[model samples]
Target: MRTFLSVIFLAAFSLFSFAQQPYAPAAALPAKNLAMFGRGLYPGNDTTYHLLKRSGFNTILLSSFYIHADGDLYSGDSHQPIIHQGKWVGDAGYVKRVKDLKTKSSISRIEILLEGRWYGQPPNTFDFIRDWYDPAKAVPGIVTGTGKESTLYNIIKVLKEVLGADAICIDDESVYHSPSIIAMGKIAADLNMHMTLCPFKRNNYWTEILEASDNNLVDALYLQCYDGGVRNEIKDWVQGLKPAQPIYPIFMVRGSFSTCDTHKGSKSVAEISKQLRGFKKDYPGMSGAAIWQMEDLNSFVKLGCAIKQPSSGTAKSVAEFLSQLKKALKKEL
Candidate 1:
């Protein structure tokens, strides 16, 4: 068994080495797009956060919490249950981290994904909200079967007053929360915040969020391109909208086999660099790509499961690639 495992490792390494060769760029490269690198946060230290900033990532999608296996909602540090089954889970760490990033570095954006429901499977929309807002029971306007509560408003209030985040990415895993969506927009507007709701790829939802505000509530229409490599479809989706606001494609880094997914796709660090090179070569509509997580990126390397072994060679290759990509964008665009 040991010998077989060794052979498997050797074969994987050989494949990675061979895949590192340079490739000819396609005849035409699209206009360069700006991209971002980010990750999820858990309770504890901010080692990964510092690592990403050092690695040249300017934006982060910092998650507040999720419903754990124990069915208890856990928030990062600051301990505010950012979300319960389908209700508000408020925590102070969420605001603190954002403020720290702003004060500490030149971090450009912090996309606050309210009530994200990524479990063993993508959580149901209702499950995205906490159970306290359940409609079959009490809570009138507070929930309204939308699973929304005024408490979420308070959380946003704290974010604006305290952290001063640039944008809020509301993952409306649930689609029917018009009142909640509208109310959330109003709060954002009062604070002069840029708001976006990543609906389940529904155009109407984006339109509703856009129209609901006194001014344009929605500044961006984010598509959660989680499954399959769908870059080609993204252009059409962006242009297909009636009014056509800016469309930001937030690719999943750890969820799919596409270049966006961090695990299992590229074989080595050099290969990962090449993947970024290819993005510059294609996809014009792409504003930028965010690493779904720095946690996944580091974990894959730590466990020896990353496509390419994490060594100085791999890390340097990735850094050089990102540096060149950014430089290329500045030079060419």
Candidate 2:
């Protein structure tokens, strides 16, 4: 009987120890502040560093790599895509800059959005039509159809070698099926990285992508709702996401160009704060939100809206409004 009691005690102790194991935060929860800063296509510059520091940004999302013309993987106009001529881009010293900055800055995460689609497509900025699709420059076994042989697989392989980033955003032009998305997700996992899928549309394209997510491809759903001042529409879209899944709302001020438009008659930062406060109250599960840019502060003023700048009128006003919004959000939470 004593032996039996001893065995029971041991089992209880073992269970207690297992339960006490350190808790790793769930990947779905929005990371601190849910704040992601967008850098211009080319951001290896001083202005970018100043803007990121002044703003309360915690993540830097960059688009520095590109598959250049001439069938080279990493050779773009200015920066070479890391995996050029079958070589790693990071090894070539591009991502090294990002890592160096990351070590020095308080930003906890860095993401490289890999733009996909063969040369000659609508958004193919590489002039891929002239270079990658040329029949003569093609490498027989590897270059395949378009001669842009750096398939999603090859491009990612090089990126992993270089950036060693915490996350990768798959900016595929036209994603339809789950297998393709899941395939991409598996590739990310193989590299010990998390994936964020950007499916840009107001249509039902995301419905199909959501169906395909069976623990394979994505850690977060990055939806770009560029319409500003439409609080109800934005609320509806947020509600449409799966109740349990995490969603990051991308609020645009430029590039996608939502900030240049009228703010539905609100002429000041105070009015904008009122709308944001209402939205935060309506949506409790919102992990966090991100602005499309740090530039374009002028566009808001032209539309008769104002922001708090650091010094003087613009910075001070905008900061107070943001602080108030933050306080209101905390109360709601």
User: lDDT values of the candidates?
Assistant: 0.48, 0.48
lDDT per residue as tens, model 2, 1-333: 999999999999999998776323222333544445344424345544544544444666665345544334542224544455666533334354655655555566666665555442543422342233334555444442222243445555656656656566755544344444455555566565667655555335555555655432455655554443233344665656552445555554421233433333322334334444565666666656544443334344343333333111242333433343344333433
* Model 2 residue 307 distance off true place after TM-score fit, in angstroms: 12
Give one digit per residue, the lDDT tens place, for model 1 in 101-153.
Answer: 64455455565656455443555433434443334545433433322244444
Global Cα RMSD, each model: 20.4, 8.3
TM-score (C-alpha) between model 2 and the true structure = 0.61
Worst 10 residues of 2 by lDDT: 308-317
Kindly report which residue stretches of model 1 are placed more than 4 angstroms away from their true locations once superposed: 1-39, 44-46, 64-97, 116-149, 174-176, 214-216, 228-232, 242-244, 254-286, 305-313, 316-333
Candidate 1: residue 26 lDDT (0-100)? 18
TM-score of each: 0.60, 0.61
- Deviation in Å, model 1, residue 111 alpha carbon: 2.7
